[model samples]
Target: MDAVIIQILNGLDKGGAYALIALGLTLIFGTLGVVNFAHGALFMLGAFVAVSVNGLLSLESVTLDPTKLTPWGTPAEIRTKLAEEWFGTFGTTLIDYSVPVSIVVAIPVMLLIGLIMERGLIQFFYKRPHADQILVTFGLAIVLQEIVKAIFGANSISQSAPASLAGTIDVISGVAYPTWRMVYFFFSLTVIGAVIAFLQFTTFGMVVRAGMADRETVGLLGINIERRFTIVFGLAAIIAGMAGAMYTPILSPDYHLGMDFLVLSFVVVVVGGMGSIPGAVAAGFILGILQSFAAMEAVKQYFPGIDQIIIYLVAIVILLVRPRGLMGRKGVMET
Candidate 1:
């Protein structure tokens, strides 16, 4: 029973990441009507943002101490974090909670990147073929990844959760879970809920939905639907950025981190339906749980290496069973 509960928690934690990434992918598709293969690169950039913030916070100054000598008679060197020297305890706190702090910085940075990408490149592809969209965006993704590799190198950089939340919490009798994972799960829920609320209840969202359904009619109604959709693209980038930033403590990030999650997230997007936000979220959690269960010893004994292929296997089965997915619209992506 405890093991089952633990696995469920693990599933939710993993699902939160999948859902967040998939949600961004769906938003961009629904709003822009453009396939963005570069979306994963945005996720990678977000993780790098966190890494950059931490590096900035930990910036150090080196000084030679004349009073202290090394074994070889050279002066000892003293290294002090500039943040700590300048801000004292607050700086220390900032360093400890860098992951959460990075989210604040990622918002504006990612929004700007999204807007630039949309206006500069994606706008040109609006009337292009899907194959063209895929090719160009894939090329863009490679360029971005190579840039990251050049800057951060190919090694994985580790990030630690805040010391305050680094330990485990008891969820039930004989079941303990890491505090950060729990925080991440709730954080994901909060973000997802906030996005849904913004779309469901806001005037801006209503107009955007109308645009999605009948873009020509909305344009004829004197609404700047194109502008709004551009903002939606920025919003999607922010979502992916937040997910990647928060996930750093859970997964050490490397230059190719975005590529790692790219395919799985695309799978989630497809399974959730081409443009269905609710469907994407649902599929992410469902697949996450199934993958977790498949990784268990009991399940592995019956089916070797099932964990390695569970998500893809389930995606195939789901696509075969429900052509339009669990909550997909009747005409969406239909031939």
Candidate 2:
């Protein structure tokens, strides 16, 4: 029982990320009618944000070799000055702060990146076929991944929480667990909550939601639907970026982390319904919990392969019964 409880808690963290990414995908599909294959790249960009923030936060004094430290070839003075300025100005606390601190920087950066992407690239693809969109976005995903690898390198970068967040704590007597994962789980939930609240209550979200229902109709009301969509794209990017930013400590920041979640995010989007916010949230948790539970030794004993595909297996079953999705409309795709 205790083990099952642990897995359930674990699954929620995974599910939270899925829900966030899927929500972004759904927003684009629901509004723009463009099947964005590059959505994963946005997820990747989000993770990369963590890498960037980590780099900045972990700025260190350059170890200059006497051979290169000379004025002729080396900028040793500049490097020394840089390290001191960064640590002194930013405070050395960031040196030991958890990776999740990147969320602060990731949000605005992602939003700006999203806006640029939508206006600069995706806007042109809006009228193209899903195939073209996918091809372009697929290529774009590769390009984005390569860029991340080039900058951050293929090796994963790790960050640890502050000393305050380190070590295990007693959830129960003799049952202490790692503290960072718990912190990540909570941080992710908070992001999800804020996003949901914005979508549920904000005026901009209301407009975006209306556009998602029917852009042509929304346009008829004199709203510049395209501008709203650009913002929505950015919002989605923010969500994914924030997810990746906070996720740095758990899995570390790898160039490939975005691709890892892409397919599952798509599955979550489909399983949740075409444009149903509640459904997306629900499906994310459902799949997350099931996958976590299936990872247990007991479930594996009964169904050997369930551990490998329990989440996807459930997705297939849901699609089989509800071709439109659990809460998807009959023709939301057409609209």
Candidate 3:
């Protein structure tokens, strides 16, 4: 029973990430009818933002003390974090909480990037062929990946959770889980709920949804639907960015990190049904749980390497069984 609970928690942790990414993907698809192959790059960029913030916070200033001599050395050198020196305890706290702090920086940075990408490039492809959209966005993703590789190098950079969240908490009598993972799960839920509520309750979100349902009619009604859709793209980017930033401690990020998650997220989107927000979230958690169970030693003994292929297998079965997915509209993805 404890083992089952542990696996369920593991599934939720993984599912949160999958759901967040898939939700963003669904938003872009549903709002703009554009296949954003570069979505994953946005995620990678968010992780790098955390890395950059941490690096900035930890920047050290070196000084030579002429009055003090090291053994066999002419002078003693001292180094101190510039942030700590400037802001003292507050700066120290910022550095310690760099990953979480990066979310603040990432929000504006990612929003700007998303807005620029949509206005400068993506808007042109709005009526283009899906193949063209895929090719162009994929190319953009590669360009971003190469640029990051050039700057941060090809090595994976590790991120640490805040000192306060670095340990495990007991969930039940025998099940213990990482505090950070639990935080991430709840964070994901909060973000998800916020997005849903915003769309369901706000006038702006209502206009966006109306535009999504019938863009031409909405525009005919004198609404600037295109501008609202552009904002939706930015919102999607923010969601993806937050997911990546929060996931840094669990997965050390590299240039290829986005590509790694990109494929699986695409699978999640497909399994959830194209442009279906609820379906995406549901599929994410379902697939995550299945993958976790498949990774168990006992399961592996019966079905070697099941964990690696489990998601794909489930995706295949789901697609075959329900062509439009669990909650997808009947006509979506239909030939």
Clashing pairs in 2: none
**Candidate 2 worst ten-residue window by lDDT:** 75-84
Tens-place lDDT per residue, model 1, 139-222, is: 999999999899999998999999999999999967889999999999999999999999999999999888777788999999
TM match of model 2 to true structure: 0.88
TM-score between model 3 and native = 0.98
Report residue 182 deviation for candidate 2 (angstroms): 2.5
Residue 190 of model 2 has an lDDT of 80
lDDT for model 3, please.
Answer: 0.92
TM-score of each: 0.98, 0.88, 0.98
| Global lDDT scores for all candidate models | 0.90, 0.78, 0.92
Error of 1 at 104 (Å): 0.8
Task: Write model 2 residue lDDT over 230-313, tens digit each, in one string.
Answer: 888888888888877766666776777777788888899889987777788788888888899999888899999897898788
In model 1, pairs of residues that clash are none
**lDDT-superior candidate, 1 or 3:** 3
**Ranking of all candidate structures by their lDDT, best first:** 3, 1, 2
**Best-fitting candidate, scored by lDDT:** 3
